[model samples]
Target: MEKVINETDDKIKQYNVCVSYFDTLQECSFSCCFPVNVKPPVIVSADILKFPRTEYICGENFALDGIEAKVCFSDNEFLLYNYGENEGLFSSDVTTLNKTGNNEVEIKIRNKYNNDGFKYILTVIVKENRLVSIDIGKNNEGDVYFRLGKQYTDKVFFDHFSVTKHFEYNKGMTHDIKNNVVFNFEKLQYLGNGSFTGVLYARYTENEKTYYGEYVCDASGNNRIILLTPLPVSLTTEKAESVNISNLAQKLKSANITYKVRYQDNTELTFTGDVFNNNTYSCNGVTYTINCNKNSIWLDWKADKMDCKETSLEAGKLYIEDFWYYGEEDLIKSVDFKNEKTLIFESENIIPEDLSSYFSATVEYITGCKITINGNQLNKSIDKENKLITVSYNGLKFQHSFSYSYSSNGD
Candidate 1:
């Protein structure tokens, strides 16, 4: 009897055979049954002879080297999966170690016949390479700034620079590449005297490889201590009185008003300039208000005067030359005036102190004419409501009704 068995698919099989003799007369036959068992191939042992180095620097390129893998089958047949170098049977999740600290790389190998895979975990210790140094400096504005040292500037390309310590001041530090090629800390206004110590971090590229580095920056000395305070004494000048209106701009350029600023070192620095806005001078982020005395230049000009025609002064026959107030003239123009039917003027509730200034007006007209409020004199009708101010001159009458309120505030 002959039979064929497939070793890969069939594990076991059974067969029966019979033999016959004396074919003509009395036929006798003997039968026997037998079974066959087939052993399937299985992986008995698999191992790696050598692995790549488990340590590397950050951003350093590396590949699998001197790695060899072999597998032993159940039939005692040994197959070389990888020898000397990678034979396309070995693969890894990481080609180069780019992350710092412990980076887990999974190396895998699979048997082609059974589709079984094996994994090896490799922890690569990637250390950071410190290649640059930082130092403290100042800009043209005398503001504290930081930059990479001159010795390393040409060797490395700056990617990002930041302050790692002093989180309160770190938020104010900014990196500007165009005009200011440094980390500017001028916006941190509250930094006081003494040694300012902080960690400076940088990420740069060198020779087509990325690197990270840190530096401890300590800034000291008188120039590093930024202290500014506006002195209590006011600054004034009488130059505005003699200068004409057209030459005021030229006069102000030459006018030098000196002021004192106290620093942390108990030393006062005198700064002289005429750049005053509304009797105020601002320098180094500090604003100082110049107190204008009787002889001061700002008090000589009647800049606070407003024209009566610009306001809601709708009176007939009575001529209003000018109107003056101590505060902003724009506040007077903000009042809503309605000319419908009655020529009424409405205003917000003015405080007690501002009422006297708001009511100041200069009037001119014919003889025997006076300004009255609610049929009484302007000074005596202070407590009356629906106040009406009227001026009558030679039978020509001028009247205006005001609709407004005020808060006395216990006055």
Candidate 2:
């Protein structure tokens, strides 16, 4: 057995030669005991890999922030010749699977002395990087619908089944807008003087329940500039209205103020005609009742007529109201007042007066907020039930003024 090497040592060819008796070239056979390469290169993590054939790679998904695999080879003399993600990529000794799931890595090793080489398959599982942001794409109408859009930077992230968390529209069920999103009831209510300055109520699915936030929208050429609350909120949607404008109406002296909606062309539509009777108001030639979901602005219009026990049987009427909501998202529709005896409550306002001896008030909020009453806490009691707070010896029933702000993360 004889073995010879070429200059490059990359070619393996066999030739047969014999000296014929007639001085002509003829075929002859030769034998040799040449060493045959028997085994492939061994890798410590190779057993964890899938296919060992031409399709030598398989992968799974990971969501953890930091995870890495350590690969050790059988021999140190073998060269870590070339390793990369693709054909034209540069080779590096250390391969990284750090991105959100779009992954491929190649680890190629070869014998330093011969033409024998091996390609190792590396299955990288990087977590999918998910993105959540407020999106205001146009609706079926030319007007834009505010919605929350989830974007995936890499397609491999989806292929690896990295999307585990399912999304819900709003935990509070404020709207029917799909994809865990919220939108304005009006088309272009965000547009103001020179820019847009209005609040938007938005919901997304990172947590199980509905959430609320207020975003101030500004128009920039063709795009909207908005700021969302970074913290989380759990303000419960109150079944009964969370606002009591019966006392707030005292500030307005129960005035009959007209509510009007102005359009882009300076055209105005009136919502309230006669403040005493709230049947339905006409706007833009369309008639509507007081509703938060519709074009008619919802208000803190609260009026209650209680039977007062004075020297004579007289009616104690508290007729106080105003139109405080510009759009659906700007109103406070509900709140959770299960606990806290001193739970400060405020309403998103606009009210009408009813001289009847019955108590009825409704408050709805679109944005997330907390209500604070100034000094009028409920202290007056009727038998065991409280009616109003008594001020002086005269027993005057007057609720103090109130203000409101956004809710904190856990409040």
Root-mean-square deviation (CA) per prediction: 18.5, 24.1
C-alpha lDDT of all candidate models, in order: 0.40, 0.30
Q: For residues 1-411, could you state the per-residue lDDT of candidate 1 as single tens digits? A: 545544345233344433334444556555554655554466667777776777776666656666677777777876777534435666788776778899888877755445555677777787765433322332322322222111224112232233221112223333322222222122123443212223433444445544444443224432332222212222233232333323222334445433344432343545554566665554433344433222222212111111111243111111111111111121121122222223222433333343333342323222112232222222312324544433321222323344444334422
Native-to-model Cα distance after best TM-score fit, residue 393 in candidate 1, in Å: 42
Candidate 2 per-residue lDDT, tens place, 185-253, comes to 123344321222234344545546554443333354332332211111111111114334332222122
Query: Model 1 off-target regions past 4 Å?
Result: 1-39, 47-50, 56-67, 83-411
**Ten-residue segment with the worst summed lDDT in candidate 2?**
228-237
TM-score of 2: 0.25
| Candidate 1 least-lDDT 10 residues | 313-322
**Deviating ranges (above 4 Å) for candidate 2:** 1-4, 7-11, 16-80, 83-116, 119-178, 184-199, 206-411
Cα misplacement distance, residue 316 of candidate 2 (Å): 39
* Leading candidate by lDDT: 1
